[model samples]
Target: MKHIYTDLAVESKEIYNPEKKKEIEGVSVEVADEKNYSVTTVKVLNQKGSQKIRKPLGTYVTIDVPNLDKTDEDLKDEISIAFAKELKALIKEYKKNKILIIGLGNWNISSDSLGPKVIDKVLVTRQYFINYNKEFDETMANVAAISPGVMGLTGIETFDIVKGIVDKIQPDILIAVDALSSRKMDRISTTIQISDVGISPGSGVGNTRAGLTKETLGLPVIAIGIPTVVNAATMVNDTMDLIIHSMKEQAEIGSEFYSLLEGLSKEDKYKLIEEVLSPFMGNVIVTPKDIDVLIDDLSIIVANGLNIAIHPGIDIADVNRYIR
Candidate 1:
């Protein structure tokens, strides 16, 4: 049984035994710690590196902005500029061609609405180019986007819908945006993970479906996502661990109850607690009470970054002017 499950590659590193895994050649990791945000870049080299890291052999860039939940426009602009820089590096090779952006989620759910919300704020130039034909600025990419509602609502596979669009547009690259699930509650709406390896649509929330990746789409796919919810079981386990540690510090060393709690192996403790809570809260997901506010701020931040990345002539100021 897996001890922990996380969609974030950085978190996966925390669980694996460092002694058993050697640093593969060509794989690189760099971190930038700033006052407002932290950026972790994981570049997987060969297939061997991918296996060692349990991630696709591509670049995974994660930006953690702790104050995202709080309304901080100046900090938001900083993050947006930083995030756009990272995106430009990843898609620099395909700047001369069309780009398709897919917003994957159920808009009716507040936590899941991040992708669609971002789509709403993006500056779509595809229609203008088609209708005008060389009238608009040549620097602007032929950028198009869609918010394909979730499988339950549309009664269609997300992959199938995306594949149809890909076949028609044949974009040089695809950028997919979706809400993700993280093991820690604090990451919800606060962390953005961008990967050249693409994404698994429903897999983030434990519903594994056909993924949207380079292998499936036959083109380079970039995925951008934010952790919007966390597993309920993990929430309970973390709380119990804190309680057990507190009890251990306060209680005598040989106290039976304290000893019992401390003696249970991590795996066994998780199993025991999971079984006890399974009847009521199996596969439960927890989100913040202020998710609506968080989503609004994050959507603008992400959309602004995309606008700057897709349009070479536009700056953060230009994006803000157009968006407002």
Candidate 2:
């Protein structure tokens, strides 16, 4: 069946709310804020909730910050700190210290460059740990990261590459970062999702590959992402809905046509809209024109977030001093 493609659990919850009861089975939502960022955490427990949400049974945390598309130094720092702190809280239960960070995307493509960009900014400590066979400094952790070029470039599956590395490094926890697609345009580059549900490379744009999960890789997996694009069909459908809503609000009350429009089910509307747009723009992906700037700024936010989360002894201030 045709449905909106979104990498956000909160959005999935929003979609399932009307159909389910007061609460979804095995699903919980917790919300908090950090400065200008709105952090939402969704926990999907059990197989039922996993099936309903179309995500694995784990916690998914999303941080929504304002003006991410625009360049603002102060706002970027705030988001980085917030993202890092939230990431720490999510991974607290995992006592493992050896961390392997996987940056999943093609750096050559700006729109898909989020993972590799962040990888460049990440503070690597694996060599230091491996060399000395002991902790080097108070601010460092056994952190290592990689950016395996996409399958088309390397001709190797993303999961396979990560699996090979995991087998050799034997890290306690695995963190994967990627660029995702959203159903709403406004959400692009403005939202970050960190989850323990693992991840499927290329799943954000519908080309789902193998997933990197604990069961598959023999270790816990943490996935962090920011939506950078939107499906054209989904965008068109939402626009049509907005237009319908505007027409209904302006049209005379009790009109036959307005009532008829109101009576159309959401599923019917989405399907009809997708069918109409599929012929022309089915595989179209929409991204902001200023994505070049957004990617650079976002990489810092995400890289710092991962740094603070992976290294418990260091905070954002310490990271700033170290990076500088």
Full-model lDDT for every candidate: 0.82, 0.83
Backbone clashes, each candidate: 0, 0
Model 1 segments beyond 4 Å from truth?
17-27, 46-49, 135-138, 255-269
Q: In candidate 1, where is summed lDDT lowest over 10 consecutive residues? A: 14-23
- For residue 189, give model 1's deviation from the true position in Å: 1.4
- Top TM-score model: 2
lDDT of 1 by residue, 66-115 (tens): 88778888888898898999899888875436889999899999989989
The count of residue-pair clashes in candidate 1 stands at 0
Expressed as tens digits, the lDDT of each residue in 121-163 for candidate 2 is 8988888887888854566778888999889999999989999
> Could you tell me how far off, in angstroms, the CA of residue 146 lies in candidate 1 after the best superposition?
0.3
